[model samples]
Target: MVSLVPSLTEAVAETLPGTLVGATDWCSHPADLDVTRVGGTKNPAVDRILALAPDLVIANEEENRAPDLDALRAGGVEVLVTVVRDVPQAFRELARVLTACGARSRPRWLDEAEETWSAPAPARPRTTVVVPIWRRPWMVLGGDTFAGDVLDRLGFENLYGTHPERYPRVPLQDLVDASPGLVVLPDEPYRFTAADGPEAFPGLSCALVSGRHLTWYGPSLAEAPRVLAEALRAVRR
Candidate 1:
């Protein structure tokens, strides 16, 4: 099997070790993972993937390109495409993928992750914020995104959750004008840092969070609530 999505790669590698023969270059978790690199998610090396001759390939709708997946299908490879717009969908898809990989039983970590999120939310009032995943042109988590849902569950209400675009590119001035109570920045897709992102919002509080914990929907989900809540609390302190 080969995985084009990083989170799915981690999930399969953990659930059914040694089953993955190839994975995209972006599959970074389980840091010691030593699999054949199949380029990237958006522009995967389809020829290299076909050369590996995987029986099945796993991909996410958002993380991978349709044309690349179609090319893999045209080459007679079975590709399992997953759609995950929110946390519940994440668990369902994870379970579905693992089951497809021939797991006789659900993985313990998946159960633990479900239990972790199923617990009641904290009593704190929701803090309205803007989550920026990229900069330069400036893009944010907008309407119906997994990351946005994750934050929503953590008491951080996304200011742009009603926007039509999933990841909207907004001008810097517009973000500032929104006047969000806080600005949540994840360290991926753009690698926002303390020095870089916080300066953009002079008066607003900024929370620098792990892109993996914030966005990934694999083994990391078990501990994401604690990891993200701590980041949010640290900024408030």
Candidate 2:
């Protein structure tokens, strides 16, 4: 099978190993992964994927374009497209994919992920935060996103979580005016770093976090709670 989504790719690679014959270049987990790099998730080489003659192709509704999946189906390739908007949805979809692959037992990481997030969050004062996923033209986490739900579980309320658009582009000044107590920056989607993102908001606290932990919904989910808590706790006010 070929995986078009990075998180799904890692899930497949970790759970089923050699079943992954091809993946996008951005599927960077399992560091020593050896597979044909079709291309990036946004612009995967459909012809190359076809050339690989994969029995199945896995994709996500958000990460991959519908046209590409249509083109693959046109070539008689079976595709499994998953829709994951929140943590629970991710678990259900992962289970569906793994079951479709004929696994007799569920992966241990799945159980660990469930347990890690299942426990009730400790009582704490909620911190209102601005989470930017991209820079340049500035886009932020808005309504109904997996990342927003994860942050909510960690006692951080997304400032724009109820915005009409899921990832709305807002002016930096507007974000500043929102008076968020903290600005949470993820390393992927824009690669925000200590130097790049923190300087944008001088007085407000900032936390540079792993994009995988913040966004990915596979094995990374198992460790995200602790990793995110550490980054958030280390916030400089």
TM-score of each: 0.98, 0.98
On a 0 to 100 scale, what is the lDDT of residue 158 in model 1? 95
On the 0 to 100 scale, the lDDT of residue 216 in model 1 is 95
Model 1 scores a C-alpha lDDT of: 0.92
List residue ranges in candidate 2 displaced over 4 A. none
Give the clashing pairs for model 1.
none
**Which ten residues in a row are the worst by lDDT in model 1?**
228-237
Error of 1 at 132 (Å): 0.7
Error of 2 at 6 (Å): 0.7
lDDT tens digits, residue span 110-169, model 1: 999999999766678889999998988899999999999999888788999999999999
Local distance difference test scores for all models? 0.92, 0.92
lDDT score for residue 92 of model 2: 94
Pairs that clash in candidate 2: none
